[model samples]
Target: MDSQTMRDLVMYWQGVTLDDEAASRLAALSTSVGKTLNAVAGGSMFDTEPAHYDRALIAMAERSDD
Candidate 1:
């Protein structure tokens, strides 16, 4: 995603303003996450099933409740 899209996402989803520093960090994090995900999934994000994504999110929520 582009910087503008990331900024909009942060503002809309998290209800927070994105300063230059925060935006830089978010961009870096987004790149790193995309790289890691691509590496793990053989460069295709669609390789994973949608159900797997939902299950992973549910598991994360359960773990956070601990």
Candidate 2:
């Protein structure tokens, strides 16, 4: 996200105003989180914990009336 956009989002959503240093820190944290999420997403979905998603979906489908 753009720095300005992130700052705007922080203000809009969190009702907080960030100075330059805080904005830079927030940007770094946001970048780290994005990279971490990307790395996690690169792994196989089946290996995720509690990986009974397919079974849960099947159960949900069976329970659906239509």
Best by lDDT: 2
| lDDT for residue 37 in candidate 1, whole number 0-100 | 76
User: Scored by CA lDDT, what does every candidate get?
Assistant: 0.80, 0.82
lDDT of 1 by residue, 1-66 (tens): 667778889999999999877787898899999898778778545555566777688777755556
- After superposing candidate 1, which stretches have Cα over 4 Å from the reference? 43-66
Model 2: which residue pairs collide?
none
TM-score of decoy 2: 0.55
lDDT of 1: 0.80
Cα TM-score per model: 0.54, 0.55
lDDT of 2 by residue, 1-66 (tens): 556777888999999998877777888889999899889799667756776888878877864567
**Which residue runs does candidate 2 get wrong by more than 4 Å?**
43-66
